[model samples]
Target: MLVLLPPSETKHPGGDRDPLDLAALTAPELTGVRTELVETLVKLAGDVPASRAALGVSEKQDDEIARNAALWTASTLPAIERYTGVLYDALDVRSLTRARRARADARLAVGSALFGLVAATDRIPAYRLSAGSALPGLPTLRAVWRPALSPVLAALPGLVVDLRSGSYAALAPVPGAVTVQVLSERPDGTRAVVSHFNKAHKGRLARLLATTTAEPDDVVGLRRLLRRAGLHVEHDGDTALTLVVPAV
Candidate 1:
């Protein structure tokens, strides 16, 4: 579970000392966490396309994505260790149809979760055809769920909560779980810096800025918030508010 300082408590503590203590964290560590979160989600999405083309592929080709999802699930979260084994056993279930049904259900859950995460981050939904819902047969269900669910569960509400609160906590997923891919902004040079921060911890980037455009006290407020989440603040001087970001 992640613990956060309430906004009220952080903003108005009676101490005159540095409000948030983030000197303990280094820049590289913060950047690495952000990169890992994004990369993991991307790979998970790639594992499941759920596109019409994927569905149209020959059985051999169609199963390839499923196989990758299975492999990824096997490698990532420990909670899925038993579930993956169940999947293996289901493949040989006396009834071929039942075996297929089981696989599909699992896949569907994974897919929905991943899609949700993608949507939360990018503000765009990933899957057009599927929503998070119950499915029919086993194989068909796994086909829909497994790919997206893990990533979405890893990110979505949890990751976003952390981002908004300015905490850089990692979300651990069940075994066979997928990592979340963070949505990236375009390469165009935007001046505002989006950041996350609070009172308990401090961000390094916040400390690095020199006092200039904004008032000294405003910079201090920004610094206190970032230090809690190991985030930073940046602005092009024109934007009304400075950008607080946990990662670039």
Candidate 2:
């Protein structure tokens, strides 16, 4: 899960391509990092010629070898998602535990990467929902929230940040009737406990979830409900459920 990238366009997308403005390390430390990076690239060159070519080593056979190596590296990593740019590559670490912070950070340093989207997003919603009823079976509703929501929740605006320890959530405008909270399921399912005073949509959503047997239709209905609740929905996978977030 260690995703490394050159400090180039690979890491910055539409943003700037230079090195990130992280806390400046001493020159010797920076040089050591560069040396390690070069060594990594050299190792990659033995199998990944493109990695070597990036370091100014050019040979047709080397290029072919590099291409295959790059493909292998990209595919072998446990990352659920990865992207290679002109100068750096990015990865998303998935299906991991909280103890894997270093691995997650390595993936994140490449670009606009995220980690623990599901757990972080679900925490607030679950807390909010528990205020009305004790969440006894909450931990039991698995398969719905935790394992599947990592990628979906990452795209959300405020879910990745710890708002409970700060006043960030307070700054959110309460547009009267629409309030969405994240909810966890027992069997590792991901869900949202949306509390809108508009009872009709809520009732509709409940009915849809209860009756819809097909996963696609269930996600479609969920997306429609979220839109009605003033949230934006993005559909990526047919089997993957839609992620709901406050609209910008």
lDDT tens digits, residue span 21-74, model 2: 212211122233323322343355464434433333346435433432332122
The candidate scoring highest on lDDT is 2
Q: What Cα-based lDDT does every candidate model obtain?
A: 0.26, 0.27
Worst 10 residues of 1 by lDDT: 4-13
TM-score for each predicted model, relative to the true structure: 0.21, 0.19
User: How far does residue 168 in candidate 2 sit from its true spot (Å)?
Assistant: 27
| Candidate 1 backbone clash number | 55
Off by over 4 Å in 2: 1-17, 20-39, 46-225, 229-248
RMSD (Cα, Å) of model 1: 21.6
**Cα RMSD (Å) per model?**
21.6, 20.3
lDDT of 2: 0.27
For candidate 1, lDDT tens digit of each residue in 1-248? 11111111101112222221112212222333323322343344364544224333344454333433333222221111112222223222223354443332222221122221211011111111222222222233234343433343444322111221211112223332212112223347433323232221211221122111222233344444434445433432421233333334
